[model samples]
Target: MRAVLQRVSEASVTINGKLHSEIQDGLLVLLGITHNDTDEDIEYLVGKITNMRIFSDEAGLMNKSVADVQGSILVVSQFTLHAATKKGNRPSFIAAARPDQAIPLYEKFLFRLESTGTVAVKAGVFGADMKVRLLNDGPVTIVLDSKDKF
Candidate 1:
């Protein structure tokens, strides 16, 4: 599993011109899943994201976690995050998990995130054509991969 977490002042997801979900003052997470990903990956990321000290404190230092600021989170499925572009201009999606294997993991990840109860959790429909919009707070973005954990 991999995730691109962007700190955002506000974010929303639209599908076919209809609003799906939205969040304010939180993280907009673009999540990708591979065939090998499991609950462990979800656990690792949930802990990291909720506790990540990217938000600023009153002293103007980046010392507060999203939980500390009572933020929200909007997670979207983005299989393209795993695109392999080494060989050609046409990227390969062999690393992305097929829907049959991915949907369950995606649901489980969302469930776990919500279970944390530290922040409001919202999500985009899996496998839907979603248009996401956000006001990136601090323009802060972080990429995390379970396979690369050291």
Candidate 2:
């Protein structure tokens, strides 16, 4: 599993012109899954993401976690995050997990995130055509890969 985490002032997901999910003062997470990913990956990321102190403190120090600021989170499924572009201009999504293997993990991720009980969580529909919009706060972005935990 991999996630692109963007700190945002506000974010929303619109599908077919209809609003799906939205959040304010939070993290917009684009999550990708690979075939070998397992529950351990979800656990690792949930722990890190929930406790990550990317937000600023009252002293202007980047010391506050999203939960500390009572923020929200919007998760979007983005299979392209795992695209393999080594060989040619056309990026190969062969590394991306198929829906059968990914959807359950995605749902479990969402569930675990919500179970943290600190920040409110919203999610884009799995396998949906989603248009995401966000006002990036501090333009703070972080990339996390489960494979790197080792």
Candidate 3:
């Protein structure tokens, strides 16, 4: 699993011109799953995301976690994160998990994030055509991969 976490002041997802979900002062997470990903990966990422000290403190230092700021989170499925581009110009998605394998894990990740109970959690519809909009707070973005924790 891989995730791109963007600290956003506001974010929203639209599907078919209808608002699906939105958040304020939160993290907008683009998540990707592979066939090898398991519950352990979900656990690790959730722990890291919720506790990440990217939010600024009163002294203007990035010393506060999202929970400390009482922010929300918006998770969106992004299979393209696994795209392989070493070959031809066209990117290949061979590393991405199929919907049957990915959907459940995606749901589980969202559930785990919400279960923390410290912040509100919203999500974009999996496999849907979603238009995401966000004002990236501090323009702070972080990339995490379950395979690279070591």
| TM-score of each model, in listed order | 0.99, 0.98, 0.99
Clashes of each: 0, 0, 0
Quote model 1's TM-score.
0.99
lDDT of 3 by residue, 21-112 (tens): 99999899999999899999999999999999999999999999999999999999999999999999999999999999999999999999
lDDT to native, each model: 0.96, 0.96, 0.96
Q: Provide the global lDDT of candidate 3 against the true structure.
A: 0.96
Residue 75 of candidate 1: its Cα lDDT?
Answer: 99
Over the full model, what C-alpha lDDT does candidate 2 score relative to the true structure? 0.96
lDDT by residue (1-150, candidate 2, tens digit) is 999999999999999999999999989999999999999999999998989999999899999999999999999999999999889799999999999999999999999999989999999999999999999999899999989986
Error of 2 at 26 (Å): 0.7
Error of 3 at 59 (Å): 0.8
Candidate 2 lDDT for residue 5 = 95
